[model samples]
Target: MATTYRPPRLIIIPGLHDSGPAHWQSWLQSQFRDARRVQQRDFSQPELQRWADRIASTVDHAGPGEWLAVAHSFGTLALARYLDEHADTPIRQALLVAPAEPDKFGLAELLPQQRLRIPCTLIASQNDPWMTPHSAQRWARRWGASYSNLGRVGHINSESGFGPFPLAKRWVEVALARAAREQRPLHASFREWSFAI
Candidate 1:
């Protein structure tokens, strides 16, 4: 079924320093033609609204039934904040990795009980120098997002040594395959996502 809606093009938003050719985001874009980067004026500014506005701009341009946002670090938090305000927007899916901090993104609403009903894969690291697995789990549970800990791989960034994370591609593949079947994740357990891939 692949959702009659095109599940939007994939948009990659980086945090702090942008991902270069060697980073996973860059690699992902290089591998997937439908994938592209979300533009931003500055990554240095601590202001989350500026980044949020850019993300919103991309979302605005994105037609219905055709958007899958892949946000890393601060970008993930920015999207989360935006969702808090624009909860009704039609986004197909989201893949949020290591949200570095909350205060920086102004996502003050996320508590232990809040859930981000969208289908999401919140990847975390057990020994991340920037965050603890507990926080990541708390956030995932709060957002109703499934959490996957990549062992002790740190933040799962370039600094963490992940070069073309194959798991991400597999995740997308599963999402598309499941969508094609028109089966809601609520009735499924992401069991197909268990491939060692």
Candidate 2:
């Protein structure tokens, strides 16, 4: 019998003020049935600790399975904080887009200072006001994530006309393929054992 492949569940972590109906993150959620957003208590004036806790708890409740996290703006910082503090996380891959400058929000101290173990891709715009391209590159290097430049697009958010971003969808598909490839060894071993019987 052929084995069916199951893609990792997607966890959408939106930025401050939350992703509205027009945001790509929200649109992506609508496309994927298993996708869910981490609900933060206060979206207007976000508290770092609270955001981190919410993210951690949501991931924990997702049980033991692969997870792909899509985090935007300040949500990237919160996801990083949760991953840095917890040794074990279900997240296998992360798509961090248009991350805000930690220093600008006085969150440099709260954000993770160390590199993350999870495979991540950081997509940033050249003209985002929240973070310069150079700063975005630096943060991607620090986090040991692959960096992609989105040209002169501003923030790559709803204002940037990314309500239903095709590029973002392609990136998610790529991540899913990569994650499946990485897990192939385990599946191969099981197949070998079954064939030996």
Candidate 3:
């Protein structure tokens, strides 16, 4: 017999300015009816604590089933902080793309210093101004997340011409398949799974 794979509830978490209509995150939300973006009260200048709180509350309200958190740029830091604080969070997997350097905005001290327990994939660009490719890879290792390097993709945003990133959608599918196979709580080393795009 064959098994059906029901896609997890997607929680779209955009970066500093929030994904505009032309952003890939916005296009992703439109593609999936069940997916929704976590709204932040202030997008102009986000405070770490506030963003973390909002992400936590949104995940909590989504109830129990599987949840796939799609976070980009600074939103990745917010998600990391939430995971660090709440050990038993409901998120099953996460696709963290173009994570902005927390240290750049003086937020390094506020974020978690340890590895995340959830299965996560960190997609980064070689020439992202917010974070260097080396730093992004290091952070992924520190967080126990699988890393993918998209060479010179310029932060992987709308300005980089990523309004409809089909590659990201494919990666999401891969993450979901891995989650289904693992079944148990994720706590494995992800370094061995690193790849390039």
Clashes of each: 10, 0, 0
Off by over 4 Å in 2: 1-6, 186-197
Instruction: Kindly provide the TM-score of model 2 when superposed on the true structure, using C-alpha atoms.
Output: 0.88
lDDT of 3 by residue, 28-126 (tens): 888777887899998777688899999988877876666788999999999999889888887877889999998888988887776787877899998
Model 1 backbone overlap count: 10
lDDT value, candidate 1, whole model: 0.71
Q: Write the per-residue lDDT of candidate 2 for residues 159-188, one digit (tens) a residue.
A: 999999877677677777665765686554
Clashing pairs in 2: none
Pick out the ten consecutive residues of candidate 1 with the lowest summed lDDT: 188-197
Per-candidate RMSD vs. true structure? 4.2, 6.3, 4.2
C-alpha TM-scores of all predictions: 0.82, 0.88, 0.86
Residue range 1-197, candidate 1, lDDT tens digits: 56344544667888777787788888877766777687778777745777777877876776555566778887777777666667676556788888775744455555224666476778888897666789888888787777888888977888889779887777766666766555565755544432222
Residue 159, model 3: lDDT of 93
* Better-scoring candidate (TM-score), 1 or 3: 3
